[model samples]
Target: MTMSTKRPFTKDIILLDNVEEVTNKIIQKLQQDVLHNLKRLGAVVGTSGGIDSSVCLALTAKAFGPEKVLGIIMPEKDSNQDSEMLAKELAATFKVRTIKEDITSALAGFRCYERRDDAVRRVFPEYDPMTYKMKIGIKQTGLSNNLPPVFSLTIIDNKGNQEDKILPVKEYLAIVAASNFKQRSRMSMLYFHAEALHYAVVGTPNKHEQEQGFFVKYGDGGADVMPIGNLYKTQVYQLAKYLGVPKGIIERTPTTDTYSAEQTQEEFFFQLPYGLMDIYWYGFENGYSAEEVAGVMEESTDQVKALFSNFERKKRTTDYLRMSPVRDYYGS
Candidate 1:
């Protein structure tokens, strides 16, 4: 039997015909996968007060009773206050057992912010580590010119002034290495709870983040099971509505929530907005021509081509983040 690459498309974008059915399937499969396959008691999800985690928690609670699902809030110094508040609100609304594990101290112990600040200070001499929210992202200006995005620092001061500057290779690596500590720290906290309760760690990355390599390798991506891994950003919203996730969370804009400054997911990783990016990714993956996708996206052909190239490049570079541990001997 041959597989069909043809998918339901609207302007070259794939569409989900039935969201409720999709929700039911994911919940049922998650329950089965945990009980029969992993023999886990329930799920431990890091609730970030975002749609993805909120929806994932709701689905997990539905799979295993509310008592079995655990929602953890791992806030750091850089985390947005609204995100923490929303996380608490969602947990209370869902009636799930919740705990707070502040990773700020752990992050500090790891010199995560310290080293990242050192890198940023190199670029902005007057940068004060105490009053600044620093994040590193790919340089965006020249991507359309066929230049690969370079890792750079984005600093937001106490007054909300913003600065964007390219970092030296060594400084970029240092900043990223330190910043990754936040994700790893959060993962560690999640595992601490999951292991204590005999539950599986649930991941919240949607298809866009998962496929486009927007995750932090074994950090946010290191879940035992990903309930929404197959769902598009739009489809996740559908399920979110069906699952009765908190309205505020459902309506909130997608953000990295990893940085102190309020940074959007588009600014952090995906250059395009999730809605547009999702369709373009689906179109390109299904072998749709760049011109056709461009027409649908209402973008220039060159812009579409550039977006497609960036997607492929990121997917290729981040493939290692998705790989299983390497072995010298091949497995049968």
Candidate 2:
């Protein structure tokens, strides 16, 4: 809750001063959570070569030793090649065993592409899955605007020609439902490895994803332990550096990597860059006034207030993603 005096209310407000101390505490807790609490002998992590997963892999290696950790690199047809390359680098760097599972065929069996494309074709009749790569992104309305978020579907042809359309609700829901199979399938694969080896699954969602409902339920959201669930994205990068994660991965832009066409996490869901989002989120959560945050961020007070409102709306609407299954009993 303390802010650095050097620049009060600035981005420095969220900087982790004692990164080593913070990381060591996480390591200690992860050991206790997995070994003692879950009665697991080892850890299973699905590495995406992203900062969150890389950090989780490193922490698991430290907690259970490299020999006791298994990193599963699950890639589908739409995944970036860089994701696989970086994941392998991370495993080699951490000295952990890794298994590569290509889920493209599995997704094929589930008709993931078929179902998703069926919806896309409704919007663009000429859309051909084989000739076009597609992605969904929130229209950038600037975080300071009070307008509701709008989602658009974009398809890029082989020639790099792009076309975008305002996604209809029915098509949007159908597309999302199909895309969720990817996460849920990955979760199943992770649990399979975990159960087979008597290892607990370590989830990689950071605070933003976990809190803002940016994850799939029982999918990426399912895990025995989420070591960095409490850490902000900025803090996750801090741990990444202290833990010696690969520099290429450290510098790589955070992405969803769920679509065939490349898309960043910011464009897909979060509208602001992580650094600015982290600062605003910290200020909002800590009860700092919009006027104070605006002064530091160099934005109008109304804009800051609007961003805060948007944050509240997002949390309220996505609260279901953070819930336990309801079990109300009338008899009781």
Each candidate's number of clashing pairs is 0, 0
lDDT of 2 by residue, 2-22 (tens): 875545577688889999999
Model 2 scores a TM of: 0.96
The ten-residue window of minimal lDDT in model 1 covers 7-16
* Strongest candidate by lDDT: 2
Per-residue lDDT tens digits of candidate 1, residues 9-88? 56524556787888889989998999889999998999999999999999999899899999999998888888888998
Candidate 1 C-alpha error for residue 49, in Å: 0.3
What is the lDDT for 285 in model 2? 85
Q: In model 2, where do residues sit more than 4 Å from their true spots?
A: 1-8, 330-332
RMSD of every candidate to native, in Å, equals 2.3, 2.3
TM-score for each candidate, following the candidate numbering: 0.93, 0.96
The prediction achieving the highest TM-score against the true structure is 2
Shift in Å, residue 130, candidate 1: 2.0
